[model samples]
Target: MQELLEEALATLVPSDAEQAAVAALCDSLLARARKAAPDGVEPLLVGSVAKGTWLPGADIDLFLRFPEGADLKTEGLALARAVLPDGEELYAQHPYLRGSVEGYSIDAVPCFAISDPTQPASAVDRTVFHTSWVHDNLTDAQRNDVRLAKRFLAVAGAYGAAAAVGGFSGYLVEVLVHRAGDFPAFVEKVASWRPPVALGAVPGAPEAEITLPDPVDPGRNVAAGVMRDGLARAVLAARQFLAESTADAFVVGAAERKPLGCVTTVVLPHPGGVEETALPHIQRQGRKLVRALEPFGVLGSHCSLGNEGFIVLETAVVELPERQLHRGPAVWDAGAFEFLAAYPQAPLRDGRFWALKPPRHLDIASAVQALLPKARVVEGLADGAEPLPAA
Candidate 1:
């Protein structure tokens, strides 16, 4: 295990030259930001880069901290734009500039300076506190463990906490690694986690599959974004890694998907917006479609968005009986009369009213098309659609 970890670290850790290049780039960007900012606005480095836990190609996060009353929307944007004139503006809680500088992607976010993480002035105000907490608490060995944990999660397809990925965030990884003492220990703990997992005693922390209270902000759950399937993937990956006991576990590979039924893929035009703002809606729409196709024996569904949106549904049966037995209200209930009045042919059996009615959709493709009027439903997997794993 030690040898495997060392080998993995050798490949994961940044070389001296790479470190020097990143340092130079950060210094130059910071200088440009500071020169562009007005009085009372302080520019500082943040994220994985600032904490020295960044991967080789990780994007640099440069935040411009404004004073109590500074206009972050206008003045902060102007300062960021002044530093990177060609940067594109992207929106989160507010607007930020995203652009490339000397081959490295950089995000120039403007946030209000705050002394308390719990009482953040803006959405990103807690980032500075997160960076400081990691820097102050994690030892050198633990930092390396964080790197390994990140690599493991990435390989397992559970590293990001974006709307699309719905996996572990970098900060969450750091906290878990620090608490577990090392990567192996962290894996052991994760492998045993049953969902609704709470890491600390945080009162009124939002209920989630996994809940880890933010150390800096007790009110916030760092793991709230983790999806149930993503958590399962991490748990399975950890168990597999422990069983294999090999360095090969760190390598990225496609997960083998065994379909439980006939697959149908639906392609739809992407609703125009940033992915972070648009993907949840897409997922929700896909889930609604899945529910609509339940009569056709839909086993599971997966949604992905890129140039277009793709929803894949796996169904045990592609076609359903034309006439389905629709259960109505109990025979003794007030609604039973209404049900009989509506159906006129509904029969009462075992104290309940049941009606044999022809369903609106008899096939998966038709059901998908009916549910999503604009969807292009394919009989099987679409050109770029991914299949869901077997249940």
Candidate 2:
């Protein structure tokens, strides 16, 4: 994994200046941790930092572990606040513990034991934190190798892409990390992961990639691709297939009633069907899907059929259907394309018929504005907006 990730992030290493800053930040945090828990406190770097795979705009992730007898909730909070006196304020809830210091968003998580310092965390008390006893019992070196593999996949952007396809969560990394003992074995497994056979967008085009094994009950070839193309493409294709195959995509966004500060949506034309019928079905299905998807965490969905019967998947904003025509799949000419393309909202890529993307940032108001140009500013809502879960 180290070999693979090093290759991908070859173009993504932090600059000397950035590295120095991180080092300084890590040192200060560690010093404070030690001071906070007079009796030894161990701090482990997790997320992109310890993984050695940070990209531009990455945040520093530090987990402070209080051996067996320390009080994590009380001590952790007081000490964190003391260090950052007047920095930007941040709130906290379950699983993740957050706060900001020196203007940088600082996420401090408490743990009982340090599994793979670089992998996503599992609360020690939960069996999920550790994995199959076999994988969990791997030697330190083997675990380090697994960390390397995760870094490699993450740097290659596979991890982020997978997260986007499915719901982005620490769990994906956890699953891969546990599979590390058999690095070669797991790679093979991931390579073989394929989407369901019935999920074809275009009748006979090509099967989409399902990079992870669980999604593909029977799986594909992990080491199938040589160098770069194989693994990356496979993972991306699989995600697209899964999005189409199951209602996972719709469900994820649907679970969130209101935009939870960040929103991402993907719209694509159905490859095989007619424009007239397909278009309306796509829009109606999309909206219905979003509402059905709410329990899974989606706020809403925006969908439209192109004049040519293409499926347009809109994310972030939830717009109602403007017209109810059933003409040959709403086929469009250059003029109609021009008008729709120029809609004040964010236009997807040029050649791509539809799009699947997240909000520019985790700012709900900004995301809403980007999605709905016609939406008027609602003052009281902005000031009284509820807090969202942490990243």
Candidate 3:
């Protein structure tokens, strides 16, 4: 099952343009690093992208470990700007990693020293960043598991890989490791995942495609717009639930508190009940919000894209609902505004499904309410919305 799931998720790898951009960026960064440090060899690619387990629309991950005790900022930042050019516009500084270069954002992470290759990063964050092994080591299964784990999250809109890194979860890491069968089997133990509903797997008339009117790029079509909207609404619903539970306001609060920093969205699942008719609009707003939240923390989920729920990782589970609901990005229609307006706290179940546990912080109610308040409403099946009884 783990191997099967990994295979399915691997299908979502990035387009040729994205791959090229990343490769060019990496080569440039390496050039700059070698120039800056005469004694150093070139930097290496690490993380999901390096592992060849990255999902479609994932970021480029690179690792530059200067000889022990060397400062990475000088070499790393120089490489970053040289590749990206406009630091203010394209690059954004991250927590541990240097900064994300624009145009398929690339993460230039530094390598920390680790004594043992066997031990996990959880046990030794200060000594070594796990991404080192993610970039350097790992068997073929482990690499596949990384791709699978990322696709699961990317489709779920839990962690926008190119946008931020903090949203990455420990559970996801554990699940990937287990699935790879390198050590304990965590993914096999929690083997349920939601599959994404195919939106435009086939193309018809271009005029009919329901994508968002690209504000920045008018040439952009609408089927992708509809998909983005659906994903945005789904993500918003998850964020709202998290805010209610954690009391950690998203963009608004984060902006006021930390002007220089960005806001992070926790990945939680939503129950299916209401219609998701505003996927286009939701996607547009969601993308805009993502830009705003970039300085804080780019947050999202790892469930499949649409309806088939194989496994889900609900993070920040304190004070969470007992049961959680989930839906694919395609399941969200323009009609979601109707029920979501009436039932702020109710589950919107159409083609939607449920996860084994209630998502804690990824609730989209509050965010949706803020974004789509006119559509807010109290729902009927609000009391006990459990996962549809197992097949």
Residue 155, model 1: Cα distance from true site in angstroms: 1.8
Rank all candidate structures by their TM-score, best first, as comma-separated numbers: 1, 2, 3
Q: Which numbered prediction scores highest in TM-score against the true structure?
A: 1
- Deviating ranges (above 4 Å) for candidate 1: 258-260, 324-357, 383-391
Q: Note the clash tally of each candidate.
A: 0, 34, 77
**Model 2 misplaced regions, further than 4 Å:** 1-8, 38-41, 67-73, 86-104, 112-192, 195-234, 237-391
Candidate 1 lDDT? 0.85
- Residue 154, candidate 3: alpha-carbon lDDT: 36
Model 2 residue 193 CA deviation in Å: 2.3
Question: What is the Å distance of residue 43 in model 3 from its true position?
Answer: 2.1
Across 36-150, the per-residue lDDT of candidate 3 in tens digits comes to 5435524666555655666556666555454554554565555544544553322222212334555566655544344444333222222133454444556666765555544
The per-residue C-alpha lDDT of model 1 at residue 369 equals 75
Q: Per-residue alpha-carbon lDDT of model 2 for 1-391, expressed as tens digits?
A: 3454344334345578777787788788777766665456666556655544344446766665556545666665555445545433233221334556554567666555544433333333222222333243455444444544444344333443221222222334444555544445555555455444222133323344323332111132222112233344435534453344332211223223343423443333353443323544545544554444332345333333333221122234333233322212122434446544544343344433342333333433343344443333332223222222211
Model 1 vs. true fold: TM: 0.89
- Residue 70 lDDT (model 1): 79
By the lDDT metric, which is better: model 1 or model 2? 1
| Model 1 C-alpha lDDT per residue in residues 1-391, reported as the tens digit of each score | 9889999888878899989999999898889988888988899999999997887788999999998777888999999998778999888876899999888899999988988888845558889999999999999898888888998898887889997678899999999999999998999999899887878767787678887789998888889889998898889888988888777567666445677689888899988878788778889888898778778777788888778888888888888887988999998888888899999987778989888888887877787777788989888888866667421
Model 3 stretches with alpha carbons more than 4 Å out: 1-10, 14-25, 71-83, 88-102, 109-142, 154-188, 191-391
lDDT of each: 0.85, 0.42, 0.39
